[model samples]
Target: MPTTDNQGSFLNLISIRRNQVTAMDNDQELEDLELFQKNVADLFSGFLASAEEPSSAKSGVETIDSPVTARDNYIPPPPLLSISWFRNLLDAFLCCEAEFKAVLVSGRDPSQFTRPPLDRLIPDLLERSIKALDVCNAVTHGVELVRHWQKLAQIAVTALQQNPIGEGQVRRARKALTALLASTVFDVKENSNGNVHGKSAERSWSFGRRGGGGGATMNNKDPNGRNLSSFSWSVAKSWSSAKQIQAMSANLAAPRGGESTGLALPVYIISTILVFVMWALVAAIPCQERTGLATHLPLPKQLAWAQPLVSLQEKIGEEWKKKEKKGNAGLLEEVHRMEKLAQSLVEFADSFVFPMEEEKATAVAAQVKELAEICEKMEEGLGPLQQQVREVFHRIVRSRAEVLDVLDPVTKLPTPVPY
Candidate 1:
């Protein structure tokens, strides 16, 4: 086509893309029509394809999205693949970004979405939002994701009269997911198997060394080869599944009569195999388990401080009512969720997986229950008239932090502080 015609066509395409983004604003429309996502892949593909098109002056074909311009081609972030059997979470990312974008287009700030969207997209949105936020959340300084989540929550509630994705649950989980994603570091290549116990790696000098470094051997004893537990073939295979695993070398392929084969014939051949196997397993255990705390544990430990928070919550509620007699509903609900989440934070910090665990878990669960209640209030309390309620929530969290010293993880006791 002519130069002017090419320019016009490109502008038309850009307009089409922008319109697609705009159309996605309504969650119901986006989900029902599947416009944004379907268009997203194609639009991005076109944008990438356009990069290959040379300048018209150089050849014949012209660009579409115009790679020469300083704009990203739009590769959506992939999801967390914390498993041996899974591939990239691009599916998860696409799903989540659509949800995030849908909420943002719906007019709420992306960070301020408080719940999953309605219009039958709640479950899918919740799953994607969690991971999509993880991309934004994968770093601490990036608080922008929080705004996105807050907006998501808002769109979800406004769009659905009755949502299958519980308003309170999504809010709490979103908050926790955001926190974990932001706080923890993500390691991509780490394995996900075995209990950790110190193990040594089998390295070699290979200077025509006395014994060859062993070849790759499967360690059934260790998922990560801690050798802390005995290896079973099924266990070893399961743990090392879908990963770049290590091998062990035991025997020498060299000539027994060779002059170079000097040194200690004093050792039993079988003993070397046993020694290498045991030690190798020990070295690999912890390394395999280090995908980061966020990957291993989802969100915060389910709240364990619910019961204690109930009475305390009532008191906080009364106190909030007294201090902030007037209100902004949205602010109030935000405050309430914050308070309960904060309480859950304390309880979760105190929890442990073993020994004296039941009590701590129970306490934490109670806190979660309170958090759930607060989430409900926050959802109901959203609007322009609940600002005071929000403040009350702040005060409650602050006061609770003071009342209960930080929970100690090891001892499972409240920290001793001057009270």
Candidate 2:
């Protein structure tokens, strides 16, 4: 047998060899990890670049060499792919960060690694993710806003048709609708090969009917802890359906006289049914505080008729300034309220009837004179309020144009028509 000293030396040599092999294996893993980080970084960079670039669609049948710079020509970035990439990138970054921290805790010196610092990359990843989410949310909100406007337009058009408003009034309503549509931006759908095609008008009203309050549940989490893309997708589908409805309404509004009336009857019946359903649903659903910037700014109560209209005008102006600094953030709720009030006013006006007999006609004429005087008073009171509302809308359109500039610098945003 060997001496004690020799045996000790032999054991030392074996330990040294084992340590060398283990170090080599660790270095290989570190290299692989570095490569993964590089790849992820590249992907992230590409995604940001694409996000910043203006969206373009390949025209299938109509190819034009000259580029169009109008707002109508501008398309929103592809949300599905962008959102997927963001999720994957975020997950990968999180994993890498955790692994890196563990390695650091386990006495591995980061100075030995040639890769970028996890500390720097993680923060950058987080910042980008937040920005991406904001952009997505803003786009989603825009779609919803446009949808609300379309609904209002539909109601207005239907009301005008049913009442047989003068030709001038009909023309004005159509012009307004067209102007609103032209100013709005929408997403372009892509095919499997990533080419955009003209979207078909498929009746998707079922989405709205089926979308219970659950569809708006943003905090919904999956069993496996994965964030579902379904929430955003549902919103997108609803938006698409809204676009279809708007198109249908526009078509129905195109014809004049009995043709328009006939075309609109079915829609009116459907709308009336929907209104009942909506009322029921509204009653069933507990009222929640408005989301976004609107939560903080509440509309002032209407002033008493005894108060001067000037006081009301001042209050509205002040409130609008406070709420509209960052854009028409809370204006949509106000617009909705105004539209409802206008509709009610129209109904109230329609309630009055005059008789054909001489004595009755005289009495009715006096009542009509009184009614006109009251209307004039109401109009005077609302004139400043309406003017302020119009200003807020114009500001919103300008803000949207700025967002479009960031999204697509090449395309020019259309100017908002003065109300």
Residues 306-338, candidate 2: write the lDDT tens digits.
122223223333444454222222233323333
Task: Give residue 124's error in model 1 in angstroms.
Answer: 51
Winning model by TM-score: 2
Instruction: List the pairs of residues colliding in candidate 2.
Output: none
TM-score of each: 0.17, 0.26
lDDT score of residue 213 within candidate 2: 40
Model 1 lDDT-worst window of ten: 79-88
Candidate with maximal lDDT: 2
RMSD of each: 31.0, 25.8
Model 2, position 351, has a per-residue lDDT of 43
Candidate 1 on 1-419: residue-level lDDT in tens? 79999999999999999988876644454353344334433433432333333445223344575475433443322111111101111232233334333333334332222221222122222222222211111111111222323343343333222223243544454455344333222222221121111222322211111123531122335456464211111122122211211211122221134211211110111112212211211221122221211101111112221122223223323433443212111112233354345545534433323333566546545555554544454344222112221222233233323222221122322222211
Task: Report the C-alpha displacement of residue 53, candidate 1, in angstroms.
Answer: 73
Model 1: CA > 4 A from native? 1-337, 343-351, 354-356, 383-419
lDDT of each: 0.28, 0.32
